[model samples]
Target: MGVTIRPQVGALPVRFDEDGILQVLLITSRRSRKWIIPKGNPMKRLAPHHAAAREAFEEAGAIGEIEGRSRGHYRHRKRKARRQFRCRVAVYVMTVERRVERFPERGERAVRWFTVDDARGAIRNRRLRELIARVAADLASSGRPAAGQPA
Candidate 1:
């Protein structure tokens, strides 16, 4: 049997305004420097969705109401110290309520909001790309804005 890869929970933070315009938030992976949603390994005692929210807060200073059900999940190879880890990341859809100027890992990563299409392109993993595409399609139907749709 192959090695067992643990599952990690993450947040796909979205900014949905009154008009249902959707926006997605992406942060640079501290290790790979690739565009990705806020995510991390499951916390010690927190629930998956709750942990995902914490990641958003620490990574992007995002405070929001996170959905309990995961919108989707994808598999990716995460690079650690000197090895690659095969991990599955379950993503919750977080509706951002407010954004703070400071975060714990503020300097560790560069956070950016992007249109779902742009986010899809920025992602290196095929599964992640498809996930974002699916998410965008679902949200756009509601007249939701793009993740990084400018004001």
Candidate 2:
């Protein structure tokens, strides 16, 4: 039997409010109707954090800075026409620097912000939800103002 494989990668884009309520950005897939974070294939010779940043911009029209160390890793399944493949994704924490309502290339997605709890429930992947929870806890304990909030 012919075997199929899916490569794994990493991504982390966080949403923060002025009140320090940590949130995450999720995009709705037009066809799948699944709410998922921004992520893509690894860049050539680029680290996972860098790739994550790039994916955030491409997928969510986001500009952000990665924070702290890598959060951790998670595994996911990719379904194809007739088979499924497993992938492992590394998670990192990021601070949103800017967001543009109109992105140049990503027209297939609808971007929205979700509070930690809502984000956790929106994502179908269990591992990714766990990562979001961990990052939200870290941000809550960091004592920083949420993004776009007046200090």
Candidate 3:
């Protein structure tokens, strides 16, 4: 039998500084404590992008307007106890309006912001890094703020 690949959703939370420079948010994974985007399994009754938004809020305390269209897809292995399952993640771009001081998983994970270049270096997944680069380039050159970005 072919291995089953799980479907997951993710959000790449981004915000602009006073200088109009873009920054992306990264959260530490609960198990590995490595820098990663906020992500989770698909939720019932919610669209994929909405579920991605929920993951961002719970994992990174980020509240934002997320794009419904996915930026890209990536595959990674999810580890649970002694088992590992391949997971395919569809990532959406979220333009952060603000972040709260408390959230569901606030203390369970560490959250931080990084510049586009820095974010690529911090993320270990090659496909994820490429996605970030592509999104960053598009946003930077677009010459207009996305939904929640500062004008």
Candidate 4:
């Protein structure tokens, strides 16, 4: 029998800096040259939004408040030891508070911030690019403060 595969659900946390500049946290995978948003396997018994927040911390050393709601979905392919696979990821937006450059579980990875436009151009996947564009547009239209602002 062929191995069974299931699509995993994941989230991408995004934030913007002051002056309405869009900034997203990106992680450089040690093995893969792909620069991607921080995301990971779903947590057991944890909601997607909370899981997203946790992943941002673990992957990018980010602490942030979840803003708005989970936005949309995107698909990506993953390669295992000898198999190729595809998974769908649900994206979410969060307002970043702080970023710690160092973390205990930091893998062979480096984290950096990118402008939304740069990020859109950097990622290889077209689906991800579209997702980022849509999310950025939504945030802009919302007119909410980046992180700290008066109501």
Candidate 5:
């Protein structure tokens, strides 16, 4: 049988420092060790945005208020022991409000903050790269972050 395609949720976590410089967070995948945003398949009884937030927390020690609506989506491969599945991820914009020193999966992943230019380079997915570009342009024009408002 072909690998079943399923929808997942992701959080594009961002934080603005005192200087108003916007930065996006990226974390290394547990298995592939690739740089990507926090994401996972949806959990039962949780809203999509909530699931995205949970993934962010568990994967990167991120705590934030996520927009109820998704900004966009991207597809990636979910690698298993000997197979892979394509997952369509609905992504939400999370304005980072807190950072914990230790979280549920702290030791399993490496997290970093990067500028839009760096993010474009870090993320390989074309759709995700375009999403970052749109977010950057929206933020640059409005002087506000992309908080899931059609960015």
Candidate 6:
């Protein structure tokens, strides 16, 4: 088995479309270009959700309100340089207010908004995809906006 790496934080940036349907924002990984949620290493001085929000801004240009509670966590192996390691990432939900044209990592990533089903299809991580599906179902059934905020 590969070495266990430090746990990371991630954000599921979401918003309601003009028609009030929920949409998710996904970004391409810097190297692989695979669709994924915005994520990064946790900052020791920042709370987990805050770190997740920061990653969203840097990776996806997403500015939003992040829920304090995590949606869930998933484990995956990551390849950095010439080594592979396992990492556990806790994901928070962010209700995105807007996206900026530029961010810290804007040049290195591709960002896009997708419908719940389309987002699920685009994501390669099975655990993350399932987590998003559950969250979308809950938000849809409750008739509430992302992060349980008022519509």
Ranking by TM-score: 3, 6, 5, 1, 4, 2
State the C-alpha lDDT per candidate. 0.82, 0.71, 0.90, 0.71, 0.86, 0.88
Instruction: Supply the TM-score for candidate 4.
Output: 0.83
- The positional error of residue 137 in candidate 5, measured at the CA in angstroms, is 2.0
Model 1 per-residue lDDT tens digits across residues 1-151: 8966869998888876565556789999886699988988998899898999999999999997787778789998877778878899998878787889988999999998876777888889898889878877876786653233321
- Cα-based RMSD of the predictions, in order? 4.8, 4.5, 2.4, 3.5, 2.4, 2.3
- Where does candidate 3 stray beyond 4 Å? 148-151
Clashing pairs in 2: 16-147, 17-146, 17-147, 18-146, 20-146
TM-score for all predictions? 0.87, 0.81, 0.94, 0.83, 0.90, 0.93
Colliding pairs, model 1: 20-144, 21-144, 21-145, 22-144, 22-145, 23-146, 23-147, 24-147, 114-148, 115-148
Tell me, by lDDT, which candidate is best.
3
Q: Count of backbone clashes for each model?
A: 10, 5, 0, 0, 0, 0
Residue 51 alpha-carbon offset, candidate 2, angstroms: 0.8
> What tens-digit string does per-residue lDDT give for candidate 2 at 2-79?
654455455466755777566778887556869987766778887777787777787788887764346777776776
Question: Best-fitting candidate, measured by TM-score?
Answer: 3
Q: How accurate locally is residue 26 in candidate 5, as Cα lDDT from 0 to 100?
A: 96
Worst 10 contiguous positions by lDDT, candidate 3: 142-151
* Candidate 3 structure quality by residue, lDDT tens digits, 1-151: 9999999999999988888889999999998898999999999999999999999999988997998888899999998889999999999999898999989998898899999899999999999999999989888898533584421
Q: Identify the superior model by TM-score, candidate 1 or candidate 3.
A: 3
Better of 1 and 6 by TM-score: 6
Model 5, residue 75: what's the lDDT? 92
